[model samples]
Target chain A: MKKVLFLFVVLFGSCAKLDNNLYNNDNKIKEYKLDDYTGEQDFILDDSYHIPPGLVTLLTLPSQADGESSSTEIKAIYIGDVSKINSDTVLLYCHGNKDHMDFYWQRAKLLAHVNGKNKYGVLMMDYRGYGLSKGKPGEKGMYADVSACMQWLKNNGLNNNRLIIYGFSMGTASACELSANAAPMLPDKIILEAPFASVAVMIQDASQLNMPADYFTDLKIDNAEEIKKCDQPLLWLHGKSDNFLNYKTHGQAVYKNYHGRYKESILIEGADHGQVPSQMGFENYLKLIGSFIRKP
Target chain B: MRLIRFICIFLFLIFICFCSPTQLVKPLQKGQRAAAITYGGPLIKFAGAPIPIPFTTLGFSYGLTSKITGYASLHTTSLIFGNLQTTVGGLFSLYEQENKFGLTVSPAIQTAYNIRNKTGFRIWPTLDLNAYYHPLQKPSFVYIGANSWFELSSLRAHNEPQANHIIPNIHAGYMLVKTKWQHQFEIKYLGLGIPNLPGVVDYIGISHKGALGIYYSLIRKF
Candidate 1:
């Protein structure tokens, strides 16, 4: 009876699943709007947050050919001088689930001004299947895609201590995954903004049922668990009223689970999933992030 | 346990993709037994194609007295996903007159335990209220009713206050009764009067509030 029951559970558990391909909106990109590109933005920046004419460079990164992830080329935008990457404190910005890099350009440009305009470098990439990248998006592909850009940064002079990974919304998965696993290399520090706890948490919260995520998806992303394995200094920020990924359930879980070297939490009131920076006041946001990096 | 405002954002779960319609609209005769198989759920746009999530169930009911009927059913689809989902309830005839209008209420407890995760044991108190009209002397009835599934846990993953406590659904059905067999066809508007907007299922709802669910049942009496 035990054997039969176990077999039944296994069969039933794997019976149905929502197609994994539906998760990515990669094909939704019209064009990569950097500066002059005006559609909709997080916030229209004053000339202060602008990246000078030639500072932003677009490049294609090569992801590692590992069994867990597909080998693919990735599109990334670097916002700083390539010649000074060795000495600069570079921040790798992992974007949320949305169209492409263009939608996140305003956020990226704002980060470039952290501490001061172009005080440090920043790199943003559209994971595979997003933007002009190749191949389909998968859970493993997300981390591997970020690793590709990391490889680019490493080959061009960025290293462990100077590398900071920042994730927002869906981007937090790859950021926390890569940092926890420390596969390509370890980051000096990590920042998560409005990070969801896990696929199970999202589905359960969304449905208001005790639904196991495996019932609908095969994706096994768990930032709450992943953060525990990370030993680097962490800065976690979330909006108090984040409607999309409720901070209390998602971000708070990740924040509390971090047994890292150090950690900080910033909960801004009335901000939503994508409005943390604007809600914190760009300067205060940058100051908070900049101070966290400069600490110890 | 804190009661938080619930929003049915995930529209596809119903067709609760858990609450269907009233299984026993009218109490069976004393000492009678019946079994049923049901299928169909909310219509969702998947890959640009409208698909009715095929939620299935197998249920059995027995009448203890002329005025009361008891039932229990397993959600076959949920089981396939390693979630043991079942609802057990008793149907009570509230108001009745032979071959005329009748009101019945089935208050059931919906239970789900995840065998795969080995966690997520949840029991929801559910109520189904229906008023039916026996339009024909040949044993057929048309009914309209409302269903509510109450979430017992006021907290969800990460100790967050569960926003949704009572999930509401409205349905209409027609039952055809024969001597040995019966069939029921029900159409449910799950999550009624709630703003289930920014939908995940692309639910075919009214004013972006709720999903349209259709159910079919076949019952054999013994």
Candidate 2:
């Protein structure tokens, strides 16, 4: 009996950890405290906050059933007038790894204040295993999380014509996956910031070696492949000196491969990872983004 | 006496829970075959709590001659950046004093790759030295060993590319032989801090402290 129990322990412990090697949710707390606000709800912008004049709407969208993850709602923060959902263009923002939505609050605020004051609606959500969402993060699970949020916008009466998709770093994989295969709900325009081409290309760039695709894992997020199939208007922004993901190998490669209807790229000279927007200066960055959105 | 030795080995296992040093291989008789599984991982302290990250290995060995044994093994860890290794090696006895002391040497080749990253591969040439001592008329033995490997490729971890070329591990253990059943427990100290080229730094742990590791295995000889 003891030997049997020991074998059982060893076999049971062989299961892989979900957070291992991928999701870095060191602060996994769902109740994010932003200026004394807890949970997702209404936050009145007082005089102290530099954000545009608008009410920040916070809520959790119901999760859809996925075989790979436990069903749980995703937490999101939308900055803008809720009444403008029908008229204004909405940016579905996908953030990078580490931490949660709280870390991305400032970016959301800046994006909302972009095109004059309160001119755009920005919606950002935490992927599963991030923030208050309950589930392990995997390739399929993350895709499901973004799809649910997109559905929430659709249920609120927003469609592809008035919706734009924006992805940053690791989030670029999610955005590209959606834009490539999600035809019925395809986004009108796509913006990629410091994006990697794919996990395979990333490895080749980092290690400078040619290896098989399934040498380590089958979790292939080939944005290069996805971008080729996507025909949306695209804007690619990258820092020339990005240390984590090389601009020459990853960002530029994806931009070159993109055979979209319309495309543009801005390779900042001195910017590093996570510093493009600030390095481009707030006013000039807003101007570039405003022009892209306003173009017919 | 048995209880005291068990306690000592248990304490030593905790002390070296942060490393994955090599294990001592006991040579078997000609035509003998054996199988074993080992669980080992580095103990990383997170928010003041010691969490053990498991790396598991499964192996099988066969005696080609009375003094030579050959083996193959596969190993994996929980970290995504950590690569899975497949290793093949052979053990050769230098000198033997059946009831007193024995010395052996092993040299092996290990190939590492990741299932998720799917890009690079690292090759390691390793050498293991082991010495065993058995008191007269006793079935229990005390052993000491050291493993050295040359890192020959650039490996990625913590989202950074690190090129390390040297790694060494030291270990000690106890073993008991009971008919066809053999039990072994080991504690190891893996050398951390592989110096990189100028202007390059590699992260081995969350802090500056070295890693320790432990291993236990039950071998079924046939």
Going through the candidates in order, their DockQ values are 0.26, 0.07
TM-score of candidate 1 relative to the true fold:
0.77
Worst 10 residues of 1 chain B by lDDT: B1-10
TM-score of 2: 0.60
What local lDDT score does residue A289 receive in model 1, on the 0 to 100 scale?
94
lDDT of 1 by residue, A1-98 (tens): 99986776678875655434335354555567777767556777888677787999999888754684546888999999999999999999999877
Cα lDDT, all candidates? 0.80, 0.67
Which regions of candidate 1 are displaced past 4 Å?
Answer: A1-15, A19-22, A28-33, A36-41, A44-48, A65-70, B1-10, B13-18, B29-90, B101-103, B107-125, B129-155, B159-222
TM-score of each: 0.77, 0.60
